[model samples]
Target: MSTPWTPTEFEQRLRAAGNERYHHRHPFNVRMHDGLLSPEELRVWIANRFYYQRNIPAKDALIVAKLDTRELRRAWIRRIHDHDGHDGDEGGIERWLRLGEAAGLERSALESGEGVLAGVRLAVDGYVNFVRLATPLEAVASSLTEVFAPDLMERRTAAFEEHYGWIDREGLRYFQVRPPQGRRDSREALDLVRRWATTRADQDRVLAALDFKFDVLWSLLDVVEHACAQK
Candidate 1:
């Protein structure tokens, strides 16, 4: 029953959603990037985030499997490799583990995922299911969080290096490695979404999908902030 929309309008809406609700604006993220978080806080964040990191490759695989074109699949496969690595001692997952170790969390604790809050798991799973069921264009659009990631990464890296001396460059490898890859991956995905979303309805759906994805990211931070507040 809603009126139609233009692609520009859809893009504006997605940007507005990012401005309003993205984790970049979250106080936890601000405290984290600014190096104000205690060691315990960093450990909790690293542990909780392992759940999200583990699921990303699975979600990418699900999305890749849904693609009909080999070219698309080929591009999508990099995400899987980035997260899962060739032999498990490499890739983003391992880097995240190193981050956990740097934050003083045991390897067993991070891999166990026992510390993940219910809300965080639900938000991340919802994102995965949404991407799997949505159109490919919408799926790609949902990843527009990458558009904001590089800036966040830069700020976070500076904050850690300047304010938090507990972690050094080696300990922060996850943040160090992600921004460039995120920029490339996000640009490619955004281009694909923009090109394939030909109709107003499709464009609107893509924007909504991105908004939903932002909510997923925001919800993770919210859960963390709430847990911090409760303690």
Candidate 2:
């Protein structure tokens, strides 16, 4: 049998996976952050990204269903609520809608998916289905993308403030709130993967799951670039 990796090494592999495949490296994102995209490109991106954002809770619910402990379920449940919102709090989805408006899209248009590319929807749906069908360990491991997400969020937020300043700052709340939340969520996910992925096979599975997540994220940007090309 191949020797199992030490926890630190296992995690290094995971981080490497993100470094190689994370959507932050996608060409479209690079262009946006570099302030090269036109207003129409930004608008299309905002609306299409909502398709991914809204599906997050549904995927999280599937993950929660696979948890063996009420403690685990309770902790994971926060993710769903964070996106869908709770009493007196407008959740990430609502903030995303506001971002749509700020980017010049109508709420009705975003909700209706009128501006979302079919490929973006397909990529987002594959992510949800992957989580739904995966073992809980694999599912949680896929979310380690969050480990890389905070940096991207900060860069994206800065890009918006500096380059896309026409967007209402208030609509940027989702990015503002995500850095800490992504840290917390990724910490939890990494700990869980460490505990559960004991064998070399298990670690490899986790790595593969994270790669799948990255592919999903990266493909969304691919379609965005393609869509803008046709416009």
Candidate 3:
């Protein structure tokens, strides 16, 4: 059997997996950051990405259900609240709809899934299903993508301001809000994995789960890029 790695070694490998494989480097995302996408292309991306955003709470709910401790569940419920918005606060989903509106998409169409591509739906739903079936550790590990997300959000916001000034400034609020939240949430999830994934096999499974998440994100962009290119 393979030997377990030290906590530091395991964390390093996890970070490397995200660094090398995350969708921030996907061709479509690179083009987005470089200001190469046309307005329609950007709208297509925004609309399709909404599908994934809408499902995040669903995915997190599945993971929360598998968490054994009351404390863990209490901590994890905040993710759902972030997207779904409890206590009269606006949630990320609403913020994203505002973004779609700022991009000149009709809010009605966005709410109705008007521009969501077939491939996008399948890929996003696949992610939710994977979490539904995954062990709590694997499900939580998959979310380690958030560990690197704050930087991506920062860069994306800068790119939008610098290149895509046509989009309204107000719609950029989601990006602004995510960085600190991503940092806090990612630290918690990573700590959980470090505590629970004590064996070599569990650590490897965690890596695999993280990779699966990367593929899901990359494939979403693949379909978006291909679909947009056809126009």
Candidate 4:
């Protein structure tokens, strides 16, 4: 049986999960950052990624439903607002639509999720379903992927500015805003898991949740690449 890990060891293992499996290592994302994708390929990826972006708040809502404490709910609800926006404020979803336009995709089609691949849709839905069925701890733990996200977001924004110069600068706002936001969010999630997942089994479950999210992101990229290949 696996022995309970020290708090520091457990945290290291969690970070290792992202180091090994985060989608920044996915071939499509590597190509994106390398500036190798055609405009069509970029559009394909953006259209599909918009699905994942919009679903974040949905999955977050599922997590919110599982939380009983007003404190937990109050804190968790910010993720939803971060994506969906408060009144008079635009959010990540709108920022993503701007990216779609920058990529030369029709705003209406991107907003409606038209041209999103079959596999991409399934992958995003699986994430929402996973959170719905998971324990509150597991649901929150899955979001620990944010611990690894800021680097990718930063790299992507820089790549856009340097390599894909044709895209409107305004569309880069989503990527620009994400790094600091991701860092803040990841600290909250990592703290939650570090405090709550004290037992071996609980820590294992948290690790599994992070791994599951990694696969979801990888699957989305795989489908995006495949869809682009067929065109």
Q: Output the lDDT of residue 69, model 1.
A: 93
Q: How close is candidate 1 to the true structure, as a TM-score?
A: 0.91
Residue-level lDDT of model 3, residues 57-116, one tens digit each, is: 999999999999999999999999998887887989989999999999999999899879
Clash list (residue pairs), candidate 2? none
Q: For residues 25-101, write the lDDT of model 2, one tens digit per residue.
A: 88899999999999999998998899999999999999999999999999999999999999987899999999889
Of 2 and 4, which scores higher on TM-score? Answer: 2
Tell me which residue pairs clash in candidate 3.
none
Off by over 4 Å in 2: none
Q: Where is model 4 more than 4 Å wrong at Cα?
A: none
lDDT tens string, model 1, 8-85? 665667668777877889889988876778877877777887899999998888889878999999998999898888
Model 4: pairs clashing at backbone N, Cα or C within 3 Å: none
Model 3 score (lDDT): 0.94
Q: Cα deviation in Å at residue 222, candidate 4? A: 0.8
Of candidates 3 and 2, the better by lDDT: 3
> lDDT of candidate 4?
0.90
User: What CA root-mean-square deviation does each model show from the true structure?
Assistant: 2.3, 0.8, 0.8, 1.0
Candidate 4, run of 10 with poorest lDDT: 222-231
Error of 3 at 5 (Å): 0.8
